[model samples]
Target: MLRPELIEFSLDNQKAELKIVPNLHGPITEDDLLQLLALPDFSYLCPLHAVITQAVIQVNQLHPQDEGNIELFFEIAERRDAEISFEIASDKMQASMALTAAYGGKSLGLRDVLQNLKLQRISMGLSKAKIEALLVEFATLSPGEKCHSVIANGRAAVNGSPAKLERKVSLARERLLQPQHNSDGTVDMRNLGAIIMVKPGNLLIEKHPATQGVNGYNVYGETLIAKPGKDLKFTAGNGTEFAANNPNQLIATVAGQPVETPSGMQVDDVLQIKNVDVGYGHVDFKGSVLITGDVGEGMVVKSHGDITVMGFVDSATLEAKGDITVSKGVIGRQLKDLSLSTKLIAQGQISAQFVQYSQLKAKGNILVTKQLLHSHTQTQQQLIVSDASARRGDLVGGKAEANKGIKAVAIGATADTKTELFCAMELTELKQQLKQLDQSIKSMVVAGLNIEAQLRKLPPKEQWQADAMMVEQVKVMLEEKRRTVVFRTQEELEFEALKLEIEGYYKHYRIDALKHVFSNVELHVGTAFQRTQREHGPCQISNKNQEIRFDYSH
Candidate 1:
């Protein structure tokens, strides 16, 4: 039997030599050398198979009777690669180590394996327990045996959340348009449920901010940044303010309907009424008026804000600081006493489904969806009589006047009903009224200037010495300040009114008859007038300079 000690390696283990002692009893076989090469101490050097075979043949060639020494030189190399190797993930979130028994070279220690991992930039999540376990297992393994295990891991980053907005009030206006049913199972047509209203200091909306997410790290010791949440801000509109105690909370500063705008919320002071009939007396309110039902004969309805009539207004007197919207018709009788006729006036626009035998006046436009028949319609802006959906309507037997423009599908009936359409005409009565408004505005301005001068002449409050004379002077100053406020308020109102009047006077005057103008229709623009000699189709009459010009589309 060949002993493992018979084989010897060079100092660097790059070369090896083996000696075969003559077996007096038998010759050495190939299996004998192979079995010797498999020993733990000598197995590190791989055997050259051809060299071993030749050595065995030469040993057998020797006569069994003659004993001799046999020496063989074997080629070998040191295993320079480490027994422990690492595999890292592309994202650096996982790392694993592979261990094997070394041959012809020194086996790697745990420190060596760790150093190799450091060179790969994997420094974050190394597990000492796993490394020690793998190293112990590697030590106990036979040559060329392999052991693989995970050694490191990493954390993933998380994204943040977005901010949220909470509304305290129901800003939906659909409920206002829908009629509610009574407990008796009957629909209250006149009482479309009460409008959403908010008093002063009532909460309207609140905002909650976003949060920053937690950060994470990888096996490479690199920081993973977290995405922060999106933040939001409260958008406050007119008559709305942020709460004194909470900056995130929004509140209303007036008693009115809560209107949701694109950017935020607004509060408009409004007066809601079921009807303007015998049950309700002559109504006068400082805010907008919402009439759910009809306004009966001789009923007077007035407001500082807009007047919205869900139902009809029949032979009633209605006035408003803002627009007037009649969902249904405005009906009246052409009586000898004009005061008995339906009179609807507004500082803003007036819109109606239909107006028959009524007097309509507005500083802004007058829009009629259906026919405006036998009515006296006056507006500083356009007078339009066309169905909004069908684009068809008639200005039949009416005296319609405007400064800006007029548009109608048909002017006068096919029966040649007399119709008058006037634009930019300077009426003596309107001129007088304008003059009176200008004078009133001038008077207020003068009074405001006088008040300012008087206020400036008064002693400054900081310089006043506390005494009986100072007290009396202070009282006089307060009274003058109150008077100044009153005059300033009135001046602003009058100035706005006058500005609107002047704006109306400087409009470009034009009239468009979309369909046809009957023969009896009288067209007037500025200082010029013309009567349609015959039925005209699709024509436009405009005041250019001081003359009226007609353009026929067809």
Candidate 2:
């Protein structure tokens, strides 16, 4: 028998070879060869098992000179487990697969790789051509190299769009619809923020329908339903109607100013004119009035709706049930005209560039773009004097009252311009009325007591003989007095409750002066008042603990 030690094993880069030394002492047998292969150290060279089996079978026929010289047993190429890893992007819009080279096993082909993918249940959006190409390329790749390719793609769903509505409508009959510019390149804000007017049957709004969205496909070939676009119906408000031909088209039913509201669009009757001169007379209209030119001195313009003056208003009486906007300043004669009162009254807001020597009142806010000089202005809401570009936008020689508050760039000019700002006047008035009601109630109580004493002094029904009618009259008077006292008492209670409500609102009252407040400026919050004899700057005034306090800290 041949010794197992005579067999030697060696390995190259990828080849395993074996050599055997000739054993002259005993002839080599198949059992001897099989015993040599069973050595534990040869297990790492298992790829050469088939070749070793053949060599063992031929060992008995080998000559001594053959000597089992070094021969290739097996090609030991690298063996790698077939890998197919998948990757998906965060947005789920794409997917990829990575293939590491598979060597030394049954040769990996396209069918094998695809079969493995199918077994892994990769059914959605599979690119067969791409997978085959990747497999072919992977076949050419060297050992230790990897291949990556996008395998599946997902489509994004298209979102729906909203309907478009016309924002602006043309008013060809009305001039000054847009602001005019002077030759010197300065914009004439006189026509700025102009009202849009529409005649009967004129188009006011045109609605465009929403567009339908396209459907999308996902990587799994699943249909992704897109959201349908929203549709809106025209909400026709007062004095508006939809066109007979087109439901989406809105038209004015009356010749008026077009106003946009949350519910719908409306047209209020509008009176348009070139100027308010002597020819225009004392214009009194039941609707809105638009003046393209100046309102001449002593002209009176009254309207149930808004009044817009594109030019200056000089010594005119302008009253409106709605808002009043004067592009230019309201200028009164420097010499106070006792006969003609220069006033501007509005149920809504009043906005003007400036006001001088005029009286203005509004139920809503009063906005002054420039100075408010020697004017008596009052509003139920705020009084604001805001001139952003001016160095000084002061309230000089004016008594300004507002129910809420007053905000001004400056209070009183540098020369001690005596400006008085009164805030929360409604509450103050309520309090005063409550006090008066209390006094009236007390008077009524005393009157009732006097009447009761008179009634008691009257003779009883059994003793009354001569003046029964007089006693009856006295009794009736006493009953009436009692009823009057009760009514007055109830009124007093109601007024007291109202006064409490007003006080709550008064607590939020504030007077803000953004810039300097000169001497002789009076600040009043409810009934509390403070006169600044010395200059104080950039402060807010409010009533705190029955005292008027000024906060100088910004």
Candidate 3:
């Protein structure tokens, strides 16, 4: 086997600086210094700048232009700095050391000392005893060495990866010990490492026990909770399968507990997760939301199509033109309490949960759901929006008028008016009246003829008096009935006018129209579900009591 290299040292600025030489008379190169920085098993031996520069010059391979570059000068100054960092992170230390050395004052004899080392391959002119001491102090001279602490950084890795470095490993005390973990109860030596990293399979936590590492973790439930950590519990849990929350920090997995996954679902046209531990601020996605897990507070989710939640949503607004389905129940905000849209369909109802929408309809009646309380009319058409439960920022549903006068049901504050008044005259009633009128007209015709005949039969005075009384009474009754028919026609026209207005304002919207487009579109002012009793403050999140259905029109 090849012999290990030895190093020497000196004391300056309360730090021991090492000095080393090749076993041969050759000078060290940049590549040789790089190898020293990456040697994981042995400690490092860094020569003073004065020694390295002298050796470079002696080789006659030093670039003349290198001395003129400002960067080069700064680098040279950093190497000569009085401060010495005992860190193995050579890449990280290079910049720091350079800055420190550039500003540090140098001893007056640096040039003379450099020239002396240049003439010979001696150990910076230090005694062998001092050199040996430095080896012990720096730990580079040992047959084996190990560092307990590790620092991981992109810059620290320099031009390569930290994992791929060569290391000198120590033999274990026993040939083998128990396996770290095994469901099969057998050993797997394939996973062995010089440094065994301990990872917990799971932790059997106290039932509702207080979380040790974080606050708000006092156990109220059987399972251990991470307590809404700064990094989202669900976001990291789903977004990346393999992610390190605390860089360079070991992750301890608790047994039988699901770790937090960060999903990439967009919410309310805003809020997107850029990475495992990072999310874009208040973003908008017009197409689809693809989050891996739950959405945090105050986020808004809007979709043109259907909405799919991989996890839960807390105190967040969700809006969609099509359909909505959440894998888990919503929390932090009430569905029935908030002013949500009226046009919505969910497999579930808002029961102790948030039920905000413009108009909402479930397959079943709502007992605990607040949106279904105090409905305007639930029988005439299909669904009637409740009046008692909807809160501020809620939009209204469209209306369908059949028997209960005009009721506005859908969003956009529209109404539908359906009237059953048609002069209160059935064909039988009108036909009967017409028969009487016809009889009166026929009798009048006969009376006039009889008067003509009588005039010929008797004296002129008697004939005239009898004709006047009979014709006058009949004329009065006939005129009264005609006036009644005319009045009924006018009333019928008025009802028709109101009905036309319902169809005219089909899709027209005003004031935050995007927020309140009722689904049914057919609305009746006096008949449909209207917020007429109270003006719905500005349209926001809501679920209407009456679901606007598109059955038919006219």
TM-score of each: 0.43, 0.46, 0.17
Could you arrange the candidates by TM-score from highest to lowest? 2, 1, 3
Backbone clash tally (model 1): 0
lDDT of each: 0.75, 0.71, 0.30
Question: Stretches of candidate 3 above 4 Å error?
Answer: 1-280, 331-554
lDDT of 2: 0.71
Which ranges in model 1 have alpha carbons more than 4 Å from their true place?
Answer: 1-255, 258-266, 338-340, 426-508, 544-546
lDDT of 1 by residue, 1-554 (tens): 66667666677666566665554413777787777766666667556778878877766766363554444344322343346677888888889989877656678897798788878888887899988898888888766779988888888777455567777886322332345789999866446565557899999888786677777788888989766555554588778998889878889999886655434566767777888998789999876788878999989999776688888999999997767878778999888775338999987778887789999999888888678999998898889887643357789987998877899998898788999988877644456776776676577567667766866786766776557797686678668767755555544444555556545542445788888888988888877788877888887887655566778853
lDDT score, candidate 3, position 553:
22
Between candidates 2 and 3, which one is better according to lDDT? Answer: 2
Q: Is candidate 1 or candidate 2 better by lDDT?
A: 1
- Winner on lDDT between 1 and 3 is 1
Write the residue-wise lDDT of candidate 3 on 501-531 in tens digits.
Answer: 3333222211121223333333332222322
- lDDT by residue (492-540, candidate 2, tens digit) is 5566556667667645678888887888988888778889988877888
| Candidate 1's TM-score | 0.43
Predicted model with the maximum lDDT: 1
